[model samples]
Target: MATVTTRTVEYPADGLTMIGHLALPAGVERRPAVLIGPEGLGLSDVERRRADALAELGYVALAFDIHGGRYLGDPQEMLARCMPLLADPDRMRGIGHAALDVLRAEPRADPGRIAAIGYGTGGAIALELGRDGVDLRAIGTVNAVTTGRPGEAARIRCPVWAGVGSEDPIMPPAQRDAFTAEMQAADVDWRLVVYGGALHAFHHPPVDHAVVSGVGHHPRHAQRAWRDIVDLLAECLPISG
Candidate 1:
């Protein structure tokens, strides 16, 4: 069985105590660790489940909370809480750094072999960290919006994989094309996968809100994204077990 632990870390910048879930591999020594950033709703059961799945795959997974113990199902409120952080790149980078620090401090984690994965707004945060030169082995995102920061793509030294739904309004084809161009120009190793007929938040299962333009979940895309993430991590941060 996987060893799952829960803890809280204090973010001095926001003065908020963020909760996190750590999933450690059962019998590994100094395993590769992943810092997971939650979607717009913050840290929820869905994020915990993803961490547990990663732990089951013989990796140390840390799912960190960007929002401080507050979650609302309402879309407007969720946007209200997440938009401010997205608008300010510096603040987003600070939060990501704090979460990375928390992951690096874990005893079971190999600090040198760390990666990051995020969804939606969380994915944006991961991208910001990469832009700030976080030294991550790899970075992965799902349905993320690029803020077009100057020299951002050039700063990312690690491989990046971005997954998106073809139908996702937030990540239109033009944006994806531009992002790919930037990555290529920067010589950043990056790949993008666009799923046909899939929508945003594809990784969240059993979504109640089916509104195409609003918040919802898509389990099929989520599972596929997870598999891609595992493969990417194995390639970037190879582990011998």
Candidate 2:
């Protein structure tokens, strides 16, 4: 494993002081960067560890925050904050752009070669950024198969890959079909993976806090989804020797 360094970065977004986790690889050279969005619960250690893991693979990664500095463990609280936020596209774009700007400003990030991968609510933000016409090499989301506003998906210029549990009530077949229909209508390169028997937030580890129904961790599928994301990055925004 390569040496990785990390730090906390504070930035303003959505009228809140967002505290993001920035991770850097071992080398001094600018490298391809990835923006990681945490689940609706906010920027927890899980997302931070993902950033660190990406940095270890030689990519500059920033796990952007969703709920300012708060990690809402209560499912009700998380939905209370995220439901309205997700309803507004411009707000989501603003939050995503703020983090993208921070990631681009990093000395070790290759601004021209970046990808966005997010989970749950964060995944919705990633799609929002794409809809806002951000130039990204790839977009990956887990358990976030949100379709954008009418004609907005046409703005997505990169390949998009989404993963969801086959049994997730939060993102049922109807929603998945709508998302794919939009992508198809826009002629965007996209793919979807459905992990059988998994549930919503299947990628996340078992949490101590109370979770909504149909939310469970599936370790096997989680690893497979992660590998699929890495494959997407390698094909679209590869690191060079």
TM-score leader: 2
- Candidate 2 structure, TM-score to reference: 0.99
Instruction: Give candidate 2's whole-model lDDT.
Output: 0.96
- Per-prediction TM-score: 0.91, 0.99
RMSD of each: 2.1, 0.7
What local lDDT score does residue 68 receive in model 1, on the 0 to 100 scale? 78
**Which regions in candidate 2 have their CA more than 4 angstroms from the true location?**
none
lDDT of 2 at 214: 91
- Report the C-alpha lDDT of model 2 over 1-241, residue by residue, as the tens digit: 7889999999999999999999999989999999999999999999999999899888999999988899999999999999999999999999999999999999999999999999999999999999999999999999999988999999998999999999999999999999999999999999999999999999999999998899999999999999999999999989993
TM-score, model 1 to reference: 0.91
Best candidate, lDDT: 2
